[model samples]
Target: MKKLRLAVAVIAAAALCPFMAKAQIDLGAKAGLSIPNLTSGSSSNPINSGWSSRLGLDAGIHAEFHLTKRFSIQPEIRYSSQGGKKDGNQGFAPTPEMAGAFQQMGQPVPPYLYATYKSEAKFNYLMVPVLAKYHFGFSPKWDLYVAAGPFVSFLLNGKNETSGTSQIFADDAHKQPLPFPAVDFTRDQDIKNDLKKANFGISGHVGLAYHLNGRSAIFIEGGGNYGFVKIQKDAKNGENNTGAGVVVLGYSYRIKNK
Candidate 1:
């Protein structure tokens, strides 16, 4: 986490290198949504879930160091809430490719995979991203720009819950809680212990800004962030790598030169 913060700081400083003569330091805030899903390791269900409509809220403050007429460095620290859930039958149907694999394995056709485990997890984080933006001012008061960079997230808190039957584990089977498709796991299993603690990812940002009189501006940004960490830890000490996506929209104040 310290390394991530240091990297952002370094990038922010570098953004200022070219502008040391006449510097413009600006700050702003933003908010948005995060949509995420779980990927299954089962060859029968290789891809976990896709595009489930879950929304997350994001807000951040950024400082941009203008170094030249067209270049600047922006460093940000933000708070984000992101997660996803797979419901038994709420669009959680397995894909044809998955179904075909199950058929090949000679597994019984499920009435749906309410027989499968549907898990939902929530995550909160403090993220820092250093981005390089190109500013093209249409007039002396307004400008357009684009920025993209890498980001790191520190996992603050998370919860994992599941409702369904899964036989992935060979320990024991208790079907009283859910009777759909008898999952072969015992009640002694602790699902929460199987989740990841940190995440590393990338973000792409594009937005327009309007200079409000002095050094403040209101901006709206829409972009997607893709995380490369598996939200889950291995139940069998194997490997698990799942990721998350975020779409953001919000307003901010640019506190530097217009």
Candidate 2:
């Protein structure tokens, strides 16, 4: 998107601005675990509600400009795995054939059908964040730091994976079935078309680092990102937001300008 590109350009310009002033720059790479959840909007739609977290992986590289000993600016590009899963009885739209069959029996087609199933929605994204970081010194070899900033992300892919089988139900509350055979539910549903291309949000972290030498150190950090925008392009597919918590182990090397 034009707006996302412009924002990225601004961040890149900001990173380069410190070069003329002879600032310290650090390059780093990190890899870690991601725990993602889909926060649904207020709705009775089963697709929009009742989601649980799924485990995935995340990784990235960053360039850090030291504006001062205690403060710095860091820009990062990261890959995030996000989405949610649900198991057990869930609701779905009724097919025309199902409605016709039920209608002939003097039974009106309910608004939806219920079945026991398993579903997992996985979404992949490429994210960029411009962070302001501050370091706190408590020991000669270990330092603590915190960083937070705004980020923009682009969706690379999305899908819904479903499995299991159950008899069709008119109502889950009363355990009423339509006297139908058990239906197979295993399938991969491509959801990329249902999602927006670009998203913007916030990212932050609290980290502790141990200095291996004067130039390089290893660190462990925990943080999270949340999308301010809804992911679904259609309200009918379900209104949901992308969010995840991340923990990473990373290494950084400083290129000191002496």
Candidate 3:
């Protein structure tokens, strides 16, 4: 499955090179802010687990090409970080039975079952956006254009981490033998692993841009990306969709060849 996904991504990128030559190529840099929203699983222990969307930063260089007078394609290489944190009173709180087992086994019981975690997942990739821009060249000083398209992004970094208490064992009995239902034991383990990294996903964008002369435009875009891959691998017991909103504000400059 991993091989298939990688192959598809390679093909998608190869298909965009020709389109680049067909459009008006503009080379420029753009910087923007990203708001990250994290969705994860639940815990039986009440250690105050919650995720927040942080304001992330993004910077990249791109080429904008006008395939047609009214249509353009933008392929960009960007480096950006997007992920949230679970902090405050968040950690692992072992049940009474579980704590007793750890004590009996002479294992070091964690002070808190849950601890704060930060996701520093970063990506460096080439993104291709074929935008259908409706240019309203009303006057020389002012022109408005509306654009929307399907954009593709690849994963360059898969860094991830998870921290929590070992609450499954009661006094080292975890090494012994669990006589109860196997599903219960599996559920506990699943939650701990679910707080890992997110898989790659797809996004769609729509926005309006106001052109400043024939070269530059500032735009604000709002949309959502539906993550086709599971963000949390072990959280099969809970919802682990990587769906996130795309909130960006920046400027694009059209490179004119002299």
Model 1 C-alpha lDDT per residue in residues 30-66, reported as the tens digit of each score: 7766655444454333224332445566778787778
TM-score of candidate 1 against the unseen true structure = 0.65
Regions of candidate 1 where Cα sits further than 4 Å from its true position: 1-22, 38-53, 89-118, 163-193, 235-258
lDDT of each: 0.60, 0.89, 0.51
What's the lDDT of the predicted structure labeled candidate 2?
Answer: 0.89
RMSD (Å) of each candidate, 1 decimal: 8.6, 2.9, 9.0
**lDDT, model 1:** 0.60
lDDT of model 1, residue 172: 20
Of candidates 2 and 1, the better by lDDT: 2
Count clashes in each candidate, considering only residues at least 3 apart in sequence or on different chains: 4, 0, 13
Q: What would the TM-scores of all predictions be?
A: 0.65, 0.88, 0.55
Q: What's the residue-level lDDT of 77 in candidate 3?
A: 58
lDDT of 3 by residue, 96-211 (tens): 77567668878765544432333222223334444445666566655555555555555544433344332232222244332222222112122323343334455555665667
Which ten-residue region of model 1 has the weakest summed lDDT?
A: 169-178
